[model samples]
Target: MRMRHVWMTAGTLFAGLGGHLQASDWNMPVGVTDVSREVYSLHMTIFWICVIIGVVVFGAMFYSLFRYRHSQGAKAAKFHEHTTVEVIWTALPLLILVGMAVPATATLKKMYDASDADLDVMVTGQQWRWHYSYLGEDVDFTSNLATPREQISGESEKGENYLLEVDEPLVLPVGKKVRLLLTADDVIHSWWVPELAVKQDAVPGFVNENWVRINEPGIYRGQCAELCGKDHGFMPVVVEAVEQEQFDTWLAERKAAAAQEAQGVDREWTMDELMERGEQVYGSICASCHQADGSGLPPAFPALAGNQALLDEPERHLDTVVNGVSGTAMPAFRTTLNPVEIAAVITYERNAWGNETGEVTQPADIADMLSE
Candidate 1:
């Protein structure tokens, strides 16, 4: 009973500090960030220190008020100042601040040093999605929210990680520094993680870099914090930090896959083969915006079916796909997608939805694109 009372007292005192502190103490899972854990510790430390100071100062103030009350017929003595008392009060807080600065400075230094990274990734924030490019590697793809529209509108039960699941996660090797270079394709987006304690802005035309190294392998989730657009809440960040060996194997496979795709340029593909392959590529790459049926979301992603641009000139369509229009939202596929995937998607678009110009884009055409 005595121990219980002691615990209750401590709990009550802790409860007065902050609501967020309770979240950490309760082991409630939030963002996967080490910095958040550090911040929580700092918060609790400062909170307790403030509590102790408050109790001491306020206790003295209240004691003096009760002991020297006028109703008790005590006469008040008038004094101008207490220089010694003022010095002690001012100096004590200054000393306490210096003590707090030590941990804070260390954390700040860690946050700033986004250098000597094992892997470098460029994160480009679009209106409602994130595009990740593995620096110096052939792996690059857009990661959009995978949650269904019905669930977002409360029409259906939300999944376990609704609005948090992405088409592709930013994969990394655990225990290595993963430096992220951020920039925006459209509006401003802030990438934030509560656990790693990293938040950096993705601004237009400007690159911002931040780094993180996980101590353990786990799925870390974050979100686009800035008010980007209508689908801002939908754009979530998911990082899968895996063992170093697994990550290496994944990279090796990706490189081998790229090489295999490069070999496809020399081969002759029939229209039927290209069309079938194109459909699969189209579904993954173009379906997000242009939609599955090729109807396309009007006023934004224009329809490809019977459109003058696609139906009238097959060569122009090839040019546009290979070399995306500048000053527009459409990004060039020359670097992101391999020759086979780009050719497949382009061929699929031209032939699908009755836009049949009976045209097929070969991998060689895309290979020649790099020159232009």
Candidate 2:
């Protein structure tokens, strides 16, 4: 009765665990793409193959243990390895491995074939953000994590998306082969979107390519699969797949806005305007490292809030921002940011956090500095 109860308890425990796993979805998602589904199939096939092998091998061992027990007066028969048995075991495993490899190889071949893509997008990974340039579309933008600071600091309730949301998502047209040329600006990072079954490394000074075609129109989110830096966990990738018409419309709107922004490159701006725009730019680009409050997490990221050097030397600050300090995490913003953006962010940094520099560096000033 005790043995039976023990068995019953073990069975109950396994049953409960199985139920919990099922509820929590302890399995890869059946993604909405052909390659994703194929990958899922491959994963399940290998898993089931392992399960079957385990069951057969363990079943025979357990049966032998029970049947050959000394308590039952069974004599142990010691024998050397039989050639036939050895050959059978080895051949079976080899055949199983070959079978698994064939499909995996085919899937890999399909993944590598990024030819005849409908669109090409250059994806550049920074310390904690993604810069996307739509090749042949005249659209470019930096996608940053949009999750509020309060939620991240545990001061406010987390949203449904939480760390998975971004200010600007990579938008793609459904049923189109979108090829991504991945590279990094500073360190090695990974561009991963599981629903599309595309995960490629973004290494500095080198480019890697991957393609994906979304079968459905929806929002899919992922994170940086590689550890880049302190804020690696904060970088998220959001993809919004839409119809071709909708995608074209979005592209047109983006191009129009880009043109309008370019017009302001030579125009002078007020301090209030610079500060307002700078606040937005700073939050998106600078906040991840120096923090939202300018009280940086040193000794890596130095505090920008009350730095005496920054308050005193305005030209030095501009030079540093344009041409970053060597052997540090600071990246040169000359190519990344336009004159207006650089001016605004510089002004904001000097004036914000009660430093009260009362500086209003304009785009013309930045342009002049760039020329020299």
Candidate 3:
């Protein structure tokens, strides 16, 4: 009995972790899209079907138990087989399943039809962050957790959206069909937004497509549905839908900024600039594993504060960053990061967290190496 109780407790905790339920929130969200509504409709339909089945089956079962109780001197009516009863039960269930499958299949077909989209965006999942790149628009940026370390560590009060907040929210135009191409770098990740009814796996080397057409313009939050790594719970997805004009304006600004950053590749960067840029990059891209202070969660993620191998072998460090070590957690950043960001982060790592090597790897040098 004690062991059974322990198993039940464990099962409940695991179910909660799987995002199936909370004390207050048990039902699936009725999202802000047409397909979302269809999904909700289907969910409720199946749910009520199950409920009715349980009621009828249990009602008959308890009725039999009470009505034909041996304690009440009720004799067992021995019956071999009833073809009519068997046929009715089987036919009813088959009909119910066919009824359920029709709507589910229709919803799935609609969800998969990501054709003739107004915009196309590539969503790449990194260790614990999301990178959004607009196809042909030349607008892309990494979105990281915006919650402060103090809040995570219990040093300060947690905000309302603590883990749900991100440094950048994916902006889409309301009433416009935005097609999302999902893929991951290291492991399998699921891009899930409850309100949008978008939960798709980002399998490495495989691009899974899904689309969303938001009926309302508002902010929607979600998290990595897959258990990618240790910081899986911290990976939040925030999408902000706005007017078409507003999205266009945002895209223009992003494109202009991209152009300016692209031009920075030829210029010589000072230590201050590199360090500043590197800190931000590291905090978003590398800090999840290496930590905020360079003191990594070792064995899996070694400490970089005074690592002799990294300090002594600059060429090896650059190679390791650009071309990741095979059969390890490190991913090649050649495609993930641009030349400028690569140089800035490398230079910053050499100098930050009491590991003052005074090494300044310029953007030009990094670009040249990348070309080679």
Which residue pairs show collisions in model 1? 32-195, 33-195, 33-196, 34-195, 34-196
lDDT for residue 192 in candidate 3, whole number 0-100: 99
> Candidate 2 — which residues are off by over 4 angstroms?
1-24
Indicate which candidate wins on TM-score. 2
Each prediction's TM-score against the native?
A: 0.75, 0.92, 0.91
Predicted candidate 3 versus true structure: per-residue lDDT over 18-80, tens digit per residue: 455322367788899999999988887788689679968998999899998999999987999
Q: Lowest-lDDT window of 10 residues in candidate 3? A: 15-24
Of 1 and 3, the candidate ranking higher by lDDT = 3
For candidate 3, give the lDDT of residue 317.
Answer: 91
Predictions in order: lDDT? 0.80, 0.91, 0.91
Which residue pairs clash in candidate 3? none
Model 2 agreement with the true structure over 1-372: per-residue lDDT tens digits: 998998799779856864564335577766888999999889877876887799689989998999889999999778987999899999999999999999999999999998999999999999889999999988889899999999999999999999999999999999999999999999999998877888899999998999998999999999999999988989999999999999999999999988888788788899999999999999999988898899998998889999999999998899889999899999988877878899999999999999798988998878888888
How accurate locally is residue 58 in candidate 1, as Cα lDDT from 0 to 100?
Answer: 100
- Among these predicted structures, which one has the highest lDDT? 3
In candidate 1, residue 274 scores what lDDT?
A: 85
Runs off by more than 4 Å, candidate 3: 1-24
The worst-scoring run of ten residues by lDDT in candidate 2 lies at: 17-26
Better of 2 and 3 by TM-score: 2
